[model samples]
Target: MNPAAQEPLDPRDRPARLTVGVVGAGRVGPALAAALRLAGHRPVAVSGVSDASVRRAATLLPDVPVVTPAEVLARAELVLLTVPDDALAALVQGLAETGAVRPGQLLLHTSGRYGTKVLDPALRAGALPLALHPAMTFTGTSVDVQRLAGCSFGVTAPEELRLAAEALVIEMGGEAEWIAEESRPLYHAALALGANHLVTLVAQSMELLRAAGVEAPDRMLGPLLGAALDNALRSGDAALTGPVARGDAGTVAAHVEVLREHAPAAVAGYLAMARTTADRALAHGMLKPEMAEDLLDVLADGDSLGDTRGGAGGGAR
Candidate 1:
């Protein structure tokens, strides 16, 4: 057995403060480097390709040198690879091939879709591998540093290095949740579905309101959407309301038709969400089986409501 494995880690103990290098001064990188600096770690160097990135690095880590990737890796005890997800693997391989990543250094990446396996080349070069992905979005500003506090980090690392990985997250003012190596993709997909798609959904709602000439659409949506989101988070399926949850088949059909006519681009998404909402409401007993059947029928037919606004007793076809 390795002697290092024999020593158990203390949960309360912090990882040793190190000279950190940020290998990509994008939004995530500089924000993270700033957090590390607040935690008493020194940011020695950063590598940035674009003008925006260089400016961000200067703003976030003023005294730190903006250097090449090789120099960043060579100069620091901890190297943070915060490049785009697509570029991560290749960067690691390049660093490893050029002998830039040395043994006994700690190597980490900020990619949610990937775990430590993507840093395999660095690991093979005798560096410790960790995946430390903050669950919040970044705006590449100082505000992001404040947002890091109380956020969750999806962490994946070797069993021996778990404590070290978690310690780093704690130092960055985040709680670390251990994710299985194989589950990283699913975990990331859930985040994207919730956070990324939600922005699109909100934009579509505001667009529809504008098209209908509603004054101050965002102001109209603010409280309602905020309350709905809060309630949904706190109550889950029980918080569901609206036509789909209430099993108002005619109303659902009318919504689809109006969206199709006005917001043609959003029609498909509306139908898909309505169907899913009805299914969940039914399963959760929020909607009766008969009502769910009617709703599903209306959604499937797409034109089930014939003159719903003008006519009474618009029977389901």
Candidate 2:
């Protein structure tokens, strides 16, 4: 037998069944632990920062002990720092200062915008830092726990930690996608722009409908909006509709005027987004490239489209 072939594979080179300790047992931590447990990982500990966190941990992950961060670090081979984004750095620093971080351990945080840099202290202590963010919203309910099993998670780490994080993601029943460190912010921003901003947009729409004396707001626009969102997700950018997509300068001007009349505060955001949509429409070949400049100028003026161009034709309202 060859010398290399005769040697046993190093443990680090192969996937190891890890004992996980979830820190910050609020909405995400317990949900993640439950998902991991369902996928065959052991939940060794859960650390909570506040009374609410403690109660949440008890309610969601009663099997796991609610302990201090130090205790969690001591017990778990992989420490998941699922604390609030603002607290992650402090938590890592604190753990390092206390010498709680174990050598040859794994440290992971779930913040979408942050990379492994936040866990530098833990990394310096010989732990490999990984950043894994599930691309799903948590509502702090059993539903969220259930939903986590099928979500897509963004996994980022140094070369040494990449396979380990991917294995964990796979074990959790989530699709693991790698993101480049520099692209993380743009990746996160796109999700926020599409998902988070949709909430605000829907709220605005519901408020407007209610103000217009729609007795059952949900009955009126909820299905319509839901279908639109479904279509957007299914069709991607081809779901672009309304005035800009059709190069309907008249309808576009009319909408700006009406929004200014009825919802003055919405005008700026409306115009800004309209300009962006027009750009997309042009890119999609739905609108002429020449039309984009005029549309942009009209939106930029924000007062009126005095010389608005383009005929209203085939766009969905």
Candidate 3:
């Protein structure tokens, strides 16, 4: 870290001086606070559910006070509620229940699944509600802490809160895009279906590889996955490939059969994704209309198709 970079001396560092408090000091809270501090802003207070989290905060944010969520709001002008998704609403409600939030304070959450709606109570209390979700994974590692610089942050808030949230996201060296407040749940659902479900899909692939006696699935798959991801990123819909993209009905039938026999649990996800994927392949002009129809017919025919290893298609979605 550059010494100059450590100082929030620039005029643009206004967001840093905006007294910030963090709740749920798990993976995201500490990382966010560290980013704020590195940007030369004050991370005034933090809170967590467990001793371990508090201890972690003590190490990473040594100068900041360890306080209850209420104390955090009491002292800080900007409060980031980085708790688990299920717990976020409860935390906001809990704070509102106690009337702990101060007027004119800014309340934000890191949940991709929710927008300002989670902080309805705070909004009702004359605080502004914002949602700033980093569109990347956080493994709670030091590397992830460093790598947040270039990630895109999905930001949503009422018009009054939007500029501050965008400024905060920009201060973290990330790009910020405004999402509709009402559309946030649907938007977040799409992200979950893409990112979270991709995790499951990759894990399932690893499981299949392990069952096949492949050694070190991570080592084996990482490079292949990386290249496929690169192609997908560059070409967008044009990157679609493999059996379904080629309109190979026989291969699609085989895949369904194999899943039914060996990975029955995965059949539903496989079929659903395949049908959607086939539609994309058709749209991308990768498959002829007849072939796409044939593939969709095979995929949609509920009873007959069995699971088999189908063609390897590179997908960008």
**Which of the numbered candidates is closest to the native, going by highest lDDT?**
1
Estimate the overall C-alpha local distance difference test score of candidate 2: 0.77
The reply for model 1, stretches above 4 Å from the true place, is: 1-15, 303-317
How well is each residue in 183-300 modelled by candidate 1, as lDDT tens digits? 9999999999999999999999999999999989999999999999999899999999999889898898788878878876786667667777876787788898877777878777
Q: Model-by-model lDDT, in order? A: 0.86, 0.77, 0.78
Please report how far candidate 3 places residue 127 from its true position, in Å.
2.1
Minimal lDDT window, size 10, model 3: 1-10
TM per prediction: 0.89, 0.83, 0.83
Summarize candidate 2's per-residue lDDT along 56-164 as a digit string, tens digits: 8887777789888898888877778998888888989999989888777778899988888888898788777899999998877668777877789988889866777
Model 1 weakest 10-residue run by lDDT: 308-317
Per candidate, the number of residue pairs that clash is: 0, 0, 11
Candidate 3: C-alpha RMSD after superposition: 6.4
How do all the candidates rank in terms of lDDT, highest first? 1, 3, 2
